[model samples]
Target: MSDFLSSTLLFLLQASRMTILVSSAGLLIGFFIAVAIVGACLSHIPWLRRIGNLYTFVFRGIPLLVQLMLAYFFLPAAGIHVPAWVAAVVAISLCEGAYIGEILRGGFLGIPRGQIEACQMLGLPRLDVLFRVEIPQALKLTAPSLINEAILLIKASSLVSVVGVTEITRTAQNIASSTFRPLEAYAAAGLMYLVICGALALAGHYAERRLART
Candidate 1:
């Protein structure tokens, strides 16, 4: 309730948008890439399956912080420089893409082979079968895991500050340093994250209920 806490809240509220933006952007990128990854994993082609497995292993095997550091620090040496914002988003996207691919793969595999076989026998085009039947069902089955990953990404975005993209956590750090009130600044930051993630969870629950009714 102090004036300092009030101003700190204002600063974090403004910067929190960056957290949402980065997380949303990352997730969008991940979704698109994951489609490809899932395809690669499911491919009858041996090379594609191996490549997809390798990519997923590498990304999921490494910690995200390491990925962000490599994107920002090491890529320049390889002459693939990007802005800090781009680096942060790319790191999150690639990392989350790996996990999302696995989640979707599970969904795909969970679907009985009879369904795919039936679609094939029904004269449906391969693409049509995939888009209309398999992918849709896979997504529905894995919706909860997808939502959970999204929430995790929002919190993980706090690490983007290390690459110089000022998000809510970075804003809190700044206020904590300047005001010498680490407890208040960090507490506010945690509450903001909790609110955002809680809202997402509630929304996901509602979606699942609606899906069940259908």
Candidate 2:
């Protein structure tokens, strides 16, 4: 039991490091893609909007496992050689971008029409109005959703192990396989994940309250 605890704890430390790297990369990359997708969806160009909607639909509608597999397997056939870590990040970012884009779009739609009109009345440039007025409100409205999505990203990052990334789940699996103590290893992994998710949830609530107060 002591051996299992020690080994699991050690693996969890490794996993934590990998999880942070992958999750941060996924969220940072996904944020830009999400913004582009939302902008495209909201564009005046019909084809651009359609393309963006299709991107969101395809990514969001498909199972994440399938996306990960396609990235790791099929992309190689197309002459795009991505490392396992890169593939994992790409798959996660693409999947999360779809959902994030929708969240942002919903936030945009939720803005009061009067606010937009007021921006126009102030003689603000179109881009300035969007950046200064619309985006700020949208971000505030979407803060909770963004936090939830980030939690989802953290969980989803575990799936990267299928492609050979040594993330927390992968590390746990390795220890469990060698030690034959799957229960303990997995329980530790779950607890660590819970800690991270809980922390993010609390932070989200605090941010939401601050935003509301302002």
In order of appearance, the predictions have TM-scores of: 0.94, 0.92
lDDT of 2: 0.88
- Which lDDT tens digits does candidate 1 get at residues 40-133? 9899999999999999999999999999998888777989878898888888899988999999999999898999999888999988988898
In model 2, the Cα lDDT at residue 135 comes to: 79
Worst lDDT 10-window in candidate 1: 205-214
The per-prediction CA RMSD against the true structure, in angstroms, equals 1.5, 1.7
Candidate 2: tens digits of C-alpha lDDT, residues 1-214: 8876876887797678888888888888888898889989999999999999999999999998899989999778989997888888888889888988899999999999998899888899988987888878988999989988989888888988999999889988888898788999899999889988898889889998998886
Model 2 residue 116 lDDT score: 88
Instruction: Extract clashing residue pairs from model 1.
Output: none
Candidate 1 error regions (>4 Å) = 78-81
Residue 198: error of model 1 in Å?
A: 0.7
Report every candidate's CA lDDT: 0.90, 0.88
The residue-level lDDT of candidate 2 at 92 comes to 86
